[model samples]
Target: MSTVTVVNRLEIRFADLKKAGRGALVTYTMAGDPDHETALAIMKGLPAAGADVIELGMPFSDPMADGPAIQLAAQRSLAAGGSLSRTLDTLRAFRETDHSTPVVLMGYYNPIYARGVDRFAAEAAAAGADGLIIVDLPPEEAPELTEHLNAHGIHLIFLTAPTTDARRLPAVLAQAGGFLYYVSITGITGTASADEAAVKDAVAALRKSTDLPIAVGFGIKTPAQAAAFARIGDAAVVGSAVVQTLADSLDEVRAATEKTVPAVLGFVATLAEGVRAARR
Candidate 1:
């Protein structure tokens, strides 16, 4: 086990939520979507709009787990010159003003691998990333990046799908830090609606093995859905729905950029309200 020296932002944020007796509202957006400046504006505004945590998607050409919304967002990001280097630069810039809100980089592993695991970990920590969620990196192959990330005080967040059985749960929980992201639905992102009863049962089962906070994502589109998940888990993660909002608001690259920030923030505030009101 790697010892974490620095105070992790995720731990702090979740602790604050526990103290407040409210679930967290975690939002996700692709880095440099539409355009770099617009995406940065959205990122900076998220915390103020009631986002407890932010997951910035590092654009990759082949995102297997992502659905059309996130895939399109990645395309737009790459088209606008979003790269691993650019993503870190955006994080560094965001850190200048908002140093408290936990930010996690979520995407596939190829980009990180191409950058070299050790170097990517070092750069990510230097750029103020609090954690990472590599969709394709299984626990068996995660040590390469986890060791480096853990050493730098950056958490390597893991995902547990509906298909993850009891026998496989331990392995996933072993490498998980910051939080465990539960894929609410069995398939790809943003396609199906999560079954509330199933999610409740899954969270209950997961709690028996690990004390880490569990955040449910995928198929969570509405505030009602987010509230339901929040009541069941420690936090609710909203991604594809928010990304779809960006897609709908875009006119062109620059015009869409102008509309994306406010539109996404407004939607996030509603989701936050739902999460905060859960169990109250």
Candidate 2:
């Protein structure tokens, strides 16, 4: 078998951010939202708009952990013919113009399982994806997929929630790569707000266990909220609010309008400013 050596852009990005003395701004968007062309435009524009890392959400019919905004985004994407292959294509296209920005594929596991772990891993690696955030795939049950991704030098990023106590944390951190995503809230994504004090305590506790970068996500809506969480963690991830911006810009039929791409990118720029200035 031929071995492929990966550059590990995620790790390099984190190290660079650390040197700059600021937190990274991570943005999430559904691939093929409204339409493939508009979604690609937004993806291409993200890095210039100040996003440090891009989390390209893979559309799934049953995104249980996601709230209404993301669920609606997935619905719109699926209607526009979004699939695993198409999502990879989007990443590949984004890589054509911009290569340094780290991109993580975030979503559920069913689609990856349907495509087979090895094939999915190979395709993702070839497409310039830096990491993965499979929400439904717990570490205990992820060995098979993890193995395939490891062989390709792709990081299988894991999520830790507010309830991830001392006992459960070791298991979560053992196989985790790239970064540890800390779900600031307990329930589904974007429904409630993330308590700053609770998240500060949680991130402090997490630092005792692992040296991996912690990215705070879920319930972070505005620039101030992103700035607060970014100060607590190494990075800040914003999803539902970003998705909602895209959704709102769509036409009455849920189709992409002239405002779709610009609106999403503009909002991300504001959040990026918050994250960039957080530690300074």
Candidate 3:
């Protein structure tokens, strides 16, 4: 049996959101995207910009599930010396000022495997990360990492897709912690727009099987879309849109150092407003 762990920032944030009667605005940005310092600046500014939860992308050489925008972001991050160690350092730095906002490391599992699951989980918890969202690690093969993370009081968040049928949901939910990220689309991330009615129905159905918070991601771009999804789920995750925003505002040097933080934060503020006003 899975042991119930102590409340981390993720659970606290969701509890607070429930009290406020508003959904969360979860922001995703690649750590060290463009560069480490610049990405760290964006991370530090997220909370003040109204981000309830932050999903920091750990740069990987091959981000199979991502679209061109995110793939490019990873390439930029890698070029700028982004690695698993540096990603943890970035989180440690972000924890210096913001202790309440939850930070979830989102990526694949190879990095963790290379670092050793036990060592990775301990370091991640110590670095002040609240949870993890490993895209490629399904529930069946997750016990190796999940055991360590659970022991360290870190939530191992799981992703459910549009194709995840009824038979598989229970197994997925059984190992899921923090929240369930429902990929609102079938294909790669950011390739298409989310279908609202489909998302609403999915959330309603998932609620029947588990009480975990549901955060919809994939194809969510604008404040209007975030607001619509927020009304239906516990949170709305916007990734590709934010990555594209940074991409659009980059300087001639291909670095968003001068304008990325402010630009992305401003966009996040707008998203937060929409989420706060959802169902109101």
Task: Return the TM-score for each candidate structure.
Answer: 0.97, 0.98, 0.97
Residue-level lDDT for 46 in candidate 3? 90
Winner by lDDT? 2
Query: With candidate 3 superimposed using the best TM-score fit, by how many Å does residue 201's alpha carbon deviate from the native?
Result: 0.7
- Tens-place lDDT per residue, model 3, 42-154, is 99999998899999999999999999999999999999899999999999999998889999999999999999999999899999999999999999999999999988999
* Superposition error at 183 for model 1 (Å): 0.6
lDDT (Cα, tens digit) per residue for candidate 2, span 1-280: 7876679999999999999998889999999998899999999999999999999999999999999999999999999999989999999999999889999999999999999899999899999999999999998998989999999888999999988789989999989999999999999988899999999999999999999999999979999999999889999899999999999998999999999989999999999988887884
Off by over 4 Å in 3: 1-6
Task: Report the Cα lDDT for residue 53, model 2.
Answer: 93
Error of 3 at 61 (Å): 0.3
lDDT of 3: 0.92
Q: What lDDT would each prediction earn against the true structure?
A: 0.91, 0.93, 0.92
Would you list the clashing residue pairs of candidate 3? none
- The alpha-carbon deviation from the true structure for residue 20 of candidate 1, after best TM-score superposition, in angstroms, is 0.7
Q: Lowest-scoring 10 consecutive residues by lDDT in candidate 1?
A: 252-261
